[model samples]
Target chain A: EDKVVQSPLSLVVHEGDTVTLNCSYEVTNFRSLLWYKQEKKAPTFLFMLTSSGIEKKSGRLSSILDKKELFSILNITATQTGDSAVYLCAVRGGTSYDKVIFGPGTSLSVIP
Target chain B: SAVISQKPSRDICQRGTSLTIQCQVDSQVTMMFWYRQQPGQSLTLIATANQGSEATYESGFVIDKFPISRPNLTFSTLTVSNMSPEDSSIYLCSVEPRVGDTQYFGPGTRLTVL
Candidate 1:
């Protein structure tokens, strides 16, 4: 079975603290890894990492994938209360067609 | 980037009822997907709806339980049949505009079964 696991199911941090969320997946075919932020309703796209070693960043958020280890990490710097949300990791892979599997997600609460 | 919208943003229904959720994308997309997210659980792909073809459902999800319709590239609908308390969840619709592209999600419909 294709599975994606996330660490620290829930986390609470004070404002300005830096946080790192982990996602590891085991699938038959590895295509790409994606990170999303779910606030209340749907998840918003954050980053998609397909290559190893290289990092994708946007303002205070960044992410990287390690194909050799079958894992990925999302880093948030100088986090604020607005950063509180459920961070989700998804992997897309399959031999015939695109198949996406999602992790349980890491819920982070940034308190001011 | 694509803007997706889902309607009946939230709804409450009694057991044994059915509800159809609509997903509309601003631009033409190649593939649309339906997913279910139970409270405190991860998202599960229900099926993949492509225009001009029957939807392909994932294992454990059958077409009878969740019927999908894709009449065009930008529109799709998912109808949940025989609702129960256990069926209460957030139904999300996502689209992959192109192959190898990041999927974008609609706002989602929150269904509460009483």
Candidate 2:
């Protein structure tokens, strides 16, 4: 069975803190990994990583995937109170590699 | 990125009632997906709707409980039948503009069963 696992299920950090969220997966075939942030009812897209070592960055958020290790990491620097939300990591992999399996997520609470 | 929208942003319904959520995309998409997220939980695939074929449901989901319809490339609907308190969740619709592309999500419909 394909599964995605995330570490430190929940985190509470002060303002301007840097947090690293981890995601590991076990699947039949490795494809792409994605990150999303959910504040309310909707989950906003964050980043999609398909290569190893190379990082994708957007403002204060960055992510990288390690296919050999079958894991990915999302880093958030200088996090503000507005950044308080659940960070989700998902992978698209399986026999056909079409379905996206999501991790339990890391809930970050940023205190100002 | 494709713009997606869902109707009935939030609703509180009685147990045993049913709700139909609609999803609309700005552009044509080959595959649309439906997901359910329980409170404090991650998103779970409910089904996948294609324009010209019947929706394919994921494991632990049945068509009778969650019927989906994809009338065109840009629109789809998911109906949740016989609601219960356990059925309370946020229903999200997502679309992949092309095959093997990133999936974009809708704002989601929050349902509460009382």
Clashes of each: 0, 0
Cα lDDT, model 1, residue A27 = 79
Worst 10 residues of 2 chain A by lDDT: A92-101
Give the alpha carbon lDDT tens digit for every residue of B12-67 in model 1.
Answer: 99999999999999999998999999999989999999798889998899988899
Model 2 per-residue lDDT tens digits across residues A3-100:
99999899999999999999999978777898999898788899989899999999999999999999999999999999999999989888764788
Q: Taking candidate 2, what TM-score does its chain B reach relative to the real chain B?
A: 0.98
Candidate 1: residue B63 Cα off by (Å): 1.3
Candidate 2 lDDT over residue span B1-114, tens digit each: 899999999999999999999999999998899999998889999999977788999989999999999999999999999999999999999988877778889999999999
Docking class of 2: high
The C-alpha TM-scores of every prediction are: 0.98, 0.98
Which candidate tops lDDT? 1
lDDT: worst 10-residue window of model 1 chain B? B50-59
lDDT of 2 at A104: 93
Q: Where does candidate 1 clash, by residue pair?
A: none
